[model samples]
Target: MIRAKTILALLSLAAPAVAGDIPLAPPIDCTLGETCFIQNYVDRDPGPGAADFACGGLTYDGHKGTDFALPTEADMARGVSVLSVAPGTVKATRDGMPDIAMDRPGAPALDGRDCGNGVVVSHGEGWETQYCHLREGSVAVRKGMRVAKGTVLGQVGLSGRTEFPHVHLSVRRDGRVVDPFDPASGPATCGRAAAAPLWQNPLPYAPGGLVGAGFSTTVPGFDAVKAGLASPATLPAGAPALVLWAHAFGGRAGDAVAFEIDGPGGARIFEHRATLDRAQVRFFRAAGRRPPAGGWPDGAYRGTAQLMRGDEVLGQRTVTLRIGG
Candidate 1:
């Protein structure tokens, strides 16, 4: 069963991607030690005001930004360092924000400081690496102070918007963030930018679950094994409704990832096929399929996900569903 194989492949990566085995480099080198908990990063791109996004396995809306732990290395708390990814001047800094405490290992530390006390460095011409949730009052470089790449700008702290401690860092080029894991150098900038969306992915650091796998989002709280549907799951009337989020990863580009969402009556309410990105995507809304009347009647729905590697169903996931109003 090509489809069954594809489903299996996708499931294989799911646990590790969510739990971890995230890389540090081979990759790129950050000012901090080798990267760990690759699975737990949050998408805090282009610095402050940039749309925050989820980089973690789970989506914690607006809680975007990688929450690297303090040096698990000797002589340090779990997360306690903040450094520069590149050379620049302090463009902005903020401190004294409330901090949230975390008990989960590899989970973000501190509060308000998801990336720990935010710091934005101008690279001239609008290029920047927005670092955040830094140790309060520990900013070494103020606005206009020159810095070098990998410089220890400040200590990672569990301040504003954070639950654990670690450097919450990201790189921005021309007002948009580049995948820090695979950064390309160019002239920098310091332009006022629009509020960025909380990015669902930084893309540089992908969740393990995405690779060679079929994935989907349940209604806020879905039990993978249950054949349950969304409760009062509402979509804008006539608004193209696609699964909350469906992506395929590790499948090569040009390869297709297919999805079929069944409505009542065994009808294929949603079906889509698209080339997979390093991550896969099967957004059916673009296909003009809106949710059925009564917002998908209380019933059973099933989803079949297929991953094709050059016409091969390398993996797949068939999920059971139950919908109710």
Candidate 2:
């Protein structure tokens, strides 16, 4: 969230350290670019503007942690474990915050608890890692407990001042915030050579990507797509219309989303490309048409969606739906 820097400053305590770097493992148990995605990175810009470590617009001003985000609320409900990045002792933790998006009605006030349902681990040499927005009652470790790398701390959740479900990870060395992707904390030079990343296995940077795609009987609402309920495995032949939709993140103006649907026997049913007019942190688009006069033919239908920036495809997905199967 935009306020992460403030939260980290309030939570982190100074300590001494040696010179070696603390290599980190991914803190979440999921496939990157599939089950989960990097929604934001530590804000590298020191002024009022914001930029990710790659000098991209994936982060907001004052954001101090990396956000590993789930595509839908249903994914969060199924439980995704948050793991320890390295050997450490639990320094502190908080649990019991309800899993609710901050923008929802009746959501609880943060009340200085911006790092909801979280854990702070102390890796000696003044290195500490903090995991935030864990699900209610999912915290598995306690203060003073020794833990090895990959230890399960909790499940990701929308429990803090966040609009989506994700675990916010903040790394601090000797009480100063460190960008795990780039630990040398000065103004980020976009193309400058740098030291090795902190992750044990370096993560590739993605500027923007698709989150979800599917076929529906009608244009689906953004909320339904976000809840993982917009797409069904099958639609009756008599369904009023066939719609292909996609959800995406980090879209910039001038980008385009293309949608295509192919019926049985490879017959093209519809195709359309919608262009983004402005930058959006998250967005959804749909395209479709009413059924033919004969209702429909029973077989498999394939829907493909792609996010494009000129000739380069940022992300693409193909989904199949069966009719009268």
Candidate 3:
């Protein structure tokens, strides 16, 4: 028998004019190399503080939207488009803001314009959605344009108050915030689920996971990552160091972190292990070395990172890069 949620999704696609119920798909394709993660959810806490649908520390105080973060600044540079979750007419749009990550020391302050290059769509009957932190020139739709589910609205960016590259999506009804994960509109108590879910298939939120992983010939800063102002990927033979780094979120004390690097010959060139002494929202680690008196061999190189709790692995990522012409 077909599930009711599946039928609802089909109905939303077939009848875009329908009001009151709009099914949502992922705003960005995570299957692509753009392995994005949810940094925050609409604050469910009522008392002027913060809380996520899962009641985790993944969210910050007063965060009123769902944040989908790209792995690195380089990924933002390559461009990843954000999609509309449902059909609607564009109500408003803001563009031309520079894609500047706030992590830089001298980054300009946006102040009141924190949404930064955004698009809003009204789904009728007071229902609306907002997509923010879009690339300067990536807005594809203008005000009053009819857009369907999965329509490309803009590219994910680091344009607003965000220190990382991401797109923040906000859903509202009559100007009041709504938690799509909790349709019944109650606190998301641990192990106690809401009676109703707004989403046909709610996006899963993983608290602790690898946020970014990549390789470089030179050590990169939190911003100089591929998505930032990092060095070229093509490494000359005998370069100083062929570094592999990984950044993560939701790390806790006692967790084991591991790193590995393999060269063109498929040989493990370097490996290291470490333990976390405290929790962190953003964690970074790397492994590399200068070439022997000779230099690096010409070919592709691979890097892998893992986070383990006891013997079980909590998160992991692998990335590859080409060396030489």
Candidate 4:
């Protein structure tokens, strides 16, 4: 297998360097501890097989960009900036694309011309980057405008052919698609990829793991949560139902999963524990409970989930919701 260092050496010997090491910065300003994550990366394989930045199946066929996905549209509604990764001039942009989540009924159908509100910037030396799925009306720069690295271009959104809230950043060299994580910008074999990564700092890549955890006023299906549907910001005190849900990808048959909801008063309102009997590309689990007859005490409700394999915790997430009114 060709290692990263080997790829870097080969690249230096084969051609002139492009100014210096990859001068790109992350396109988003979000923390990546447990909530926000890179859900997918540019697929390297030219065929139907999948591959991610770390040489995994976290990507799908024909996917040509890195998807920095957020937990929910509620988070997108709160505003998450998509930043410019390198100093460049805006070459093109499209805006006014409705920032409607895919699961919302009657969401407008998109065409090839609709990348759903995006910006394309051209850095020197034939390097161009495209940021896709920006929030409606959030394009901050116009064509021909100059921008510095880390400049705020817009907010991430669920637009175009997307099912989740994320900014799909596509990098290109001389109009050819490139994978920033791969030195040759080509397919990765095994877990080895070629030379210097594009990010100024190391960007963490998540395998098929926990995508998000959240509390909803109504029970949510797996697709609903992924498409950011019915995400309530605040739960009414007397609401009939409150559900805690989690979404995960690349689940194996023997994985152990747990979900729980805790009331404001620290009472465990709902809990579920199970072991998957079949492998799944994506899986979801939820547990819900209604408030007592007297009504829920207004404060905080916590939802938590954990995916386990034997004694090892593969992934875990926690979400808190406020109960008012």
Candidate 5:
């Protein structure tokens, strides 16, 4: 989180105001709910507890920014550009931070660089934006460089105090943190559409969503799935087991993850549902079966996964696998 005192200091060199609200553009190149998803929103709760703009549990205590997260580290390696939300001059920047999860061994102590490898742009009129957790050596703009809306600043990475690959965007006005989704900063506005959002195109709020799904010969580790190495394009007909897995985020207790597999001729081969016992930032569930006496049939197979909250489907994905065809 960017501190108010620091923001006040950074704004001292800001350019003159252009007047009116600061219209923001989508700060990332990927599509929401697909290439990327909103992992966390600004913490709207004033107490020690946390709440998102929607009065949901998609935020952490004192979280000051919106986290747009990629599904896997593979997506980060492919390079997703982080763009500027509005026209401004680059007031400050930091680069060269290693891209590593904060919880991983050998991670560096933050000291005060919580906004690791970041860029701060002065939009004037007491308004400014901060982009954090950019990839090392990826910062493209220099101090005092003018930028327009959609200008590329850097790529999202696992730098700074982050456990995942994401770009944290913080908006501020007059040195106070502002939720772009709800600038009114009132609890009454929770779950209601913002009368005027900062983004040029307002984004929809998803309580939870599927990140990715795929087929594996056996149950895979969560780390492998997150690293994009769990799913294979094809499996042998005699494989030990045929497993289908789904990765998802923003899960709450009582939410359910359902998995189904259809073999050649659309025959139902496997089906299972797992209920979450507690809220999780991200979770994965898998179901599978061992081959029968004749070994698995050689043909195409389809797998479908859904994240359900009661009868409501929060998200769903389908994957296909070819077996010795």
Candidate 6:
């Protein structure tokens, strides 16, 4: 494991000859204690991060807080139990208050429903953490309350500005929401429990690896399929038969995966396709696991899935199967 002091020492050295260990970036004051993540892979911004979320197909003021997820599903639902990112005071809380809702399915707009049934914990030095999208009528604390880390803020849900159920975790400073994506672009507000630092690429750490960033689905080194069937136990006519399922391990809230499904005949069924999110988990089950909703007839089929970067393919794998009655 790489130590923080070594990283700092490298930063202090004149100029190292190592490839990835050079000193060019600025020094960031990373918190060595508490850490924070998006809960899902694509918890910040858009692109590969938002691939695994069913809500990714939608938009919100060109700014998406947590990744697209549906945390209230039966499979991979249930978002992370809201907690205090750091020691702070509850600045506000709302219960039974009507929140802003999305008008359409693809675009984002403004709604007064800020932090749906949520809380704002204020930290020292003008720092703060936000626990939004809480379960309706489940709030415990009131405004002006104090809380510590690991404190149960509320239950996760798909509240305001969301299409599916998920948590909307964010950090703020002096009333301004801070970016949790690029750690180098800002200061360290909390320590990370997943990765060593909070700024590491959130995709690779996603429940599954970054879609379009690495191999879409890993090929289990040898040969075998886990989780959902690649060809599925069955499929409907005209519907894409070749499908693959992936789940992120330790994935952040905003990470995404990009891949495509292909038929055994080499026909592309799902090009640049991606799974959906339901908050912290990266499993495709969050988006309704119905490869062929009505169930497909018996048949022989095969398919492949891969991650990509625009036109560049990263990781990939093949899935084969035979549908029987």
**Which scores better on TM-score, 2 or 6?**
2
> What lDDT does each candidate get?
0.44, 0.87, 0.74, 0.75, 0.86, 0.40
Q: Write the per-residue lDDT of candidate 1 for residues 44-123, one digit (tens) a residue.
A: 34333322222222223333334554322221233344667556788887766544444324544344434446778776
Between candidates 2 and 3, the lDDT winner: 2
Task: Candidate 5: give the clashing pairs.
Answer: none
Candidate scoring better on TM-score of 3 and 6: 3
lDDT of 2 by residue, 1-325 (tens): 1122311211212221225888889999999878998899999999999998778888999999999999999999999999999999999999999988889887899999998899999999889999999999999999999999999999999898988889999999889999987777786658885455788775756778789999888888888888886567888889999999999998999999999899999999999999999999889999999999988799989999988877677888889989887
TM-scores, one per candidate: 0.38, 0.92, 0.77, 0.75, 0.92, 0.46
Top candidate on lDDT is 2
CA lDDT of 40 in candidate 3?
74
lDDT of 6 by residue, 79-129 (tens): 345656556688887666332234435433436775566777777666666
Give the poorly placed runs of model 1, Cα more than 4 Å off: 1-35, 39-64, 71-79, 102-116, 182-325
Question: What order do you get sorting by TM-score, best first?
Answer: 2, 5, 3, 4, 6, 1
Candidate 4: list runs displaced more than 4 Å: 1-21, 102-104, 211-244, 249-254, 260-271, 275-283, 288-303, 309-311, 319-325
Give the distance in Å from residue 257's predicted Cα in candidate 4 to where it truly belongs. Answer: 2.2
